[model samples]
Target: MYKGERMVLRFSRGQRVAHWALAVSFFVLLFSGLTLMIPSLAPLAKGGVARMIHRVFAVVFMLVPVYYALADRKGLQALITESFRYDRDDLLWLLRMPRYFFGRVKGMPPQGRLNAGEKIHHALIILTFITISLTGLVLWFGKGNLSQNEFLGMVMLHDIAMYIMVILTIGHLYFTFVYGALQGMVTGYVNEKYAALEHAKWLASIKAEKTADGKLPQSKSA
Candidate 1:
């Protein structure tokens, strides 16, 4: 894909590391969860193996955010702040989601570092993670320490969180694969053309800052 074209840093090394770590753990949990919840999937892992694997990844999933914050507090803070903010363009982006889903992004509104769909995805993940973590803890440690009603409530909440998480994860994968974003996560960089097209505003801000600092020359990529 590199034909001497300029490139942009779409993600940092730390960001990529944390993202992949969390993604891997999430997929493991998803598969194990499928086996635990469905009898037909039990052949995927047997002898309590799936549950053991799920627990191990659950710990990693719970810690990935803490690791990211410790490794790059500023980056994590910026991401969180952006995920909570919305604008007119965000609304437009969502309205035009059908086009995006079908790979017709030529006329979409310019996005920042994280696009509208990404912000929605992040918010959902955050919400579900909190709910799932709470319910998971209850299921793990509340055995015989709770009433039947409380136990059933926790189990129901946990199942609901998993449903949300699984659906979101599937959508995330679809967009990433369709848009060729996997390279950005793997290499921490993306083609300049792609970034300018999808995240023009964010790319412009970076260029402006670099120009102000006299650290970048005035060029097509700039």
Candidate 2:
């Protein structure tokens, strides 16, 4: 029998706040950005309302990194570093993910603070944010004196970035909101039993810390 009690505060209050800001801002960007893609929706994007809303949310989204840096500098650094580094094991895990979906793998890889899927998603979000911000600035500032080719290129790039973000957002929402991860964010506490089953390595570390000191361990890598 597992001799461990399982309860965890996954996200702190500050982190939760930052996540909400990022989520809301992304939604606003998605809706307003979509108008630019569909000409029939152009009217919805006009009159500066959508543009203003987009800019406001854009600023909020940009501040997620700033707040994360200031709130927990070390944790933020670790998250960035760990989210990118992938071992051979992680690649193998990706290859075997099909087994997981089919319930053939009895146990998944021993995930660290974040799993392979989370790392991939985080990396994609970071890349998309950079791409959108750069392309958005070009369009926002009015591509003046540029050739039609240059203008169209920026537009196409921006649209592609938006599409990527939208797809990721859908996945994120489905996994988090629809699949119960949202509770972890909303309450900051995850079901211990669930953690033990889904995140055995992390649960073990938590139990170890609890055994040493009647408190949960601070995450080495958030």
Candidate 3:
């Protein structure tokens, strides 16, 4: 932010906090939940400790969206809006995404702040959260209140959702590492050059707004 240095705020403080909180809670849930499915891991989850930990983290994970909505309303709303709305460039980006695995991004279509792939990831997370949370709650509290068949059905759905989440998380980490994007989450800033190359439309919009107002746009206050 000095006279010659250039950088952009890729994530705000509130967004960063919410993101890491959810991430930590997710990992805890994932490890603990995995013990239930893998018999060899039983000792680690012995005496129902893992189940207790899983349930605790599950509450934190499920509340993340609500926390984000309250803490960073504008950012959360913008992300939600962008995730559900797509255009020609998004379609083109989807078609060209495989090339991105090879570090070839130049020929890809111009991307908004959240690209098509990111939108899909977000959509998957949202849907998974709903399904997993509902099934989890039923499993946790529906005993005696629900039939045996109904309980078993919820358990099946819960496992399916967890598998989907695990797959998506792997892909998410792969892309994040390939792009060296973890810094943005940690520092809330990204190099201007990187932003220009990866999120041209969003960077251009920010510059345009700064030019028009003679100052950078401010994040909505929590």
Question: Which has the higher TM-score value, candidate number 2 or candidate number 3?
Answer: 3
Candidate 1 Cα lDDT to native? 0.85
Ranking by lDDT: 1, 3, 2
Q: Note each model's CA RMSD in angstroms.
A: 2.6, 4.1, 3.4
TM-score for each prediction?
0.92, 0.84, 0.92
Q: How would you encode candidate 2's per-residue C-alpha lDDT over 7-89 as one tens digit per residue?
A: 57767777777778888888888888777668998999878788888888888888888998888677678778877988775
Model 2 scores what on Cα lDDT? 0.74
Computed on alpha carbons, the lDDT of every model, listed in order, comes to 0.85, 0.74, 0.85
Best by TM-score: 3
Give the per-residue lDDT digits (tens) of candidate 3, residues 1-222: 212336688888888988899889988988998897789997988899998998889899988889998889998898778888888999999999999877788988888888889999888887888999999998888767888889889989998888998899999999888888898789887777777778899888998998998987632111
